[model samples]
Target: MDSTKCQDHEPSTKLLNPEGPTATIRPIDFTRSPLADDYSSFFAMTIDNLLTPDECARLQAAAGDNWQTLSKGNAFRECQNILVFSPEWASALYDRIVGHLPEEVKALRKGDRLAEIVVGPSHLKASVGARKTVWRIKEANDRLSFLRYQPGHHFKPHCDALYARPGKDERSFLTCQIYLNDAPLSADGKSDGGETRFWTSQVGKRQKPPAMECEPAEEKEAPFLDIKPKMGRALVFQQRMLWHSGQEVKRGEKFTVRLDLMFERHFEKLQPNS
Candidate 1:
């Protein structure tokens, strides 16, 4: 990442999934913010301002209008409703961040230590076998899931499902959650509650990662991390071994888009559920 090279116009590259045109201009000062720390790259990282505040506002407006197609209303995928959409900007956004990503995240690693830690123990390996390797990032997933969390909406810890199709050279390996607004806090400013928290599960554990019925107050022991939900920040992480949940919203409305990063899988004849 050379920060100096950023300019008015950027080289254009084609998108994979839908074969669309690439982004011609950089949206924001992506260079001003770098990865928070080294460990941020291991499983998850909080990327600052991937979407400009204006862009986030526009997307939120769109989500509000198209609420009928919402997904998830259960305890596991709890939320007001997930508004799904496939906007034209999806490709452009993916284009700008592709270069900023570290080489390790740009490619899928079936043997990645992190992936093995979660997948091997969970029933996920039955579907996400180690045989399929990473070819390269294909494009942003076609669908963008916009989730609005109100007063008490939340989700329990669980690993995201793998959408893999090795025969077609398609697989989803990473998730890029774009925060549209800052999560609110209490009047006393003590708890910044609506955060997405991560937890670690050993590789030998059973398929179902620890699913708590409610926030464990006694387990007030800090989690692996509570990723910052700063407005316009994008928290990107690998799908494998990442057990996370959306903590209950304490104050105002919290908005986020759950977007997946599609990857071209190395050809393997025995690929499972895709």
Candidate 2:
């Protein structure tokens, strides 16, 4: 392997299974955020202020009127209720905001040549399993969901499920989220804890546990990353590679919009010359 090339020796299976060894969280500045770089081996990154305050407010109002309680098995029980946007609504939002992305972010979204070079051929080959390939962006924008959390609400630690459907050939490979509002402050002017927490360790098949129930005895002493909600900030990550949770909202309401980026797989079939 070339030292200049970005690569990870760990098997991709560990990313999907989540029973593997812990991986430390590495933070990167949004201005120099990795698009098609070696940093992708970790599969997660944050981009600050991806949305304008006006956009966040507009979406939040729409979600407020449409909120619905999320069911137990559908989402982790600890997650609060949510409002899902119609496909039309989501697509419009994607169109409006995608142009503001950095050149690398745009390339990654389109899966362009630079993205392929940075992420490596093996990563792409393993993901779609085609000898010859063409990558296209398939947005799950229509499936965008808005989540709200009040005091004590939280989403437990878990890895996202691999996107697979019995009849569909496409799959979701990435997760994206935009924070709509700052974590609300308490009476004393302290922020309520509505941070998204990422753990160094993965959650195995021992039955998914609630965030409160599964927390380490000395949370302050544990190795983890906590990202506080900030208005307009966005986060993107390889869905299957990270074990994460929404920490409890300690004082006031927290709001966010979630979207997934999918890829449609296509392979060329060889034809015999007549």
Candidate 3:
């Protein structure tokens, strides 16, 4: 058993198709938003119709039942997922969003640009890997994790974890989650509960998910923002200090693809002709 098999689901050699993004940006600026941030939050954004319902459906179909249960053990993420190495998909998705990102994001990609961002629980240093600053954004890393949350499946409230290749001077700083199917509402336009929720309340600032998988806690007092699952929608956020969860899928199955932003550490911002 190597990095390829023996899992509940095997990784896909070829992946899904990403179309030209055709959506406007909805910026989530923690610094200005009423959303309480123990520390000033960096920029997070969401886009509607980044691809299309048809495109999303095709991708999901292509991944048809190839998912392996990733919820084994006490995993915070309870879903069936498959790993995809799709540089083309990554590139297409990045092209759609890169032009719309805040200039700071592009600058950060140039490396050594953003000042240390000590926000949330994960403090940042003058570095660009796990536990580093997320004030920057770059092209998408070529790995995509396709996730499927059937009824009762969910992800616990926790910060996104960062990763890097063994020796690459690059690391992931942002998470781009693309929802495939719409978690439809009731007949009368009433709401059901499948949402990716962002918890803004300042609580035990644990950087990692629980050591073991456990049941969700009873309802408590904490403010949270719910991003409903709409087909073709893409949610981009910093994987730094923000605490979030995939609210339990009480009804329908929710399909999503998790992509990432890779920050280059060996690069630098070139000054204009000086």
Candidate 4:
């Protein structure tokens, strides 16, 4: 046998599971879990606001300022977000702000330009820390966004990790999901598919082009924790660790606002945690 051309071939050296070593599920109380701990579960907190029917209607009407409905009337999906800087609410919040610079920050318009408007001190202060909170803002950051699920509509099993960019380099530290409306319960006194399911593992993270078929067996039966969406409540979680998806809507609607926080200045500048 020729040494150059007939040399024995080496065995292929590749492990089937890429994350076989450093993957796990750490359990902790969903109600009072610390931010530093890594958790792969869904959690939510009901806010302490009690708005009377009249007040609810007024807020709904005046909500046009920063409020954006997901779909038009009659549509199955409807949601809103960041009313802190909407034009209709702008003037009111402006009056609430000290010195009220109306000329400098007039209308609360959508996009990157509305950052100059400041709503109020209480609104700003409420957003501090990892607590489930909201703030009235003159403008929303680029990463902040909202979503809604209408009657009969559903967001199937999916993961926040899907939002993670390529190269295994960058990831968002926090994902804030807030529920603005509560779905009414049925005759049995149980709400429909308003639960948020967070999967611990078995998601197909294999490299493939977008829209490619995912590994079915691994995703369909993953261990999961379900969280019901309540009005004025919010959930904060580590984006990459949790694979979450919305449950099917059996009766009333579901609305949620999402804020994805990127630690680096821009998406491109993200680096793995040191």
For each candidate in the order shown, give its overall lDDT on alpha carbons: 0.57, 0.55, 0.64, 0.39
Which lDDT tens digits does candidate 1 get at residues 79-192? 654434344545766775576566756654455564443223332233344455444677887566777777777776666766665567566767888888987877887765
Q: Between prediction 2 and prediction 3, which has the larger TM-score?
A: 3
lDDT of 2 by residue, 162-196 (tens): 45445765656567777889888778977688888
- For model 3, residues 143-212, the per-residue Cα lDDT tens digits are 7778888877888776666767688656676788989988857677865667988766333544335322
Highest TM-score scorer: 3
- Alpha-carbon RMSD, candidate 4: 21.6
Q: Tell me the tens digit of each residue's lDDT in model 4 across 153-176.
A: 655443443233455323343455
TM-scores, each model vs. reference? 0.67, 0.64, 0.75, 0.45
Better of 1 and 4 by TM-score: 1
Show the colliding residue pairs in model 1: 164-274
Clashing pairs for model 4 are: 65-86, 66-83, 66-86, 70-79
> How much does candidate 2 score in TM-score?
0.64
* Model 3 misplaced regions, further than 4 Å: 1-21, 31-34, 72-75, 109-115, 118-138, 201-219, 267-274
Ranking by lDDT: 3, 1, 2, 4
Q: What TM-score would candidate 1 get against the native?
A: 0.67
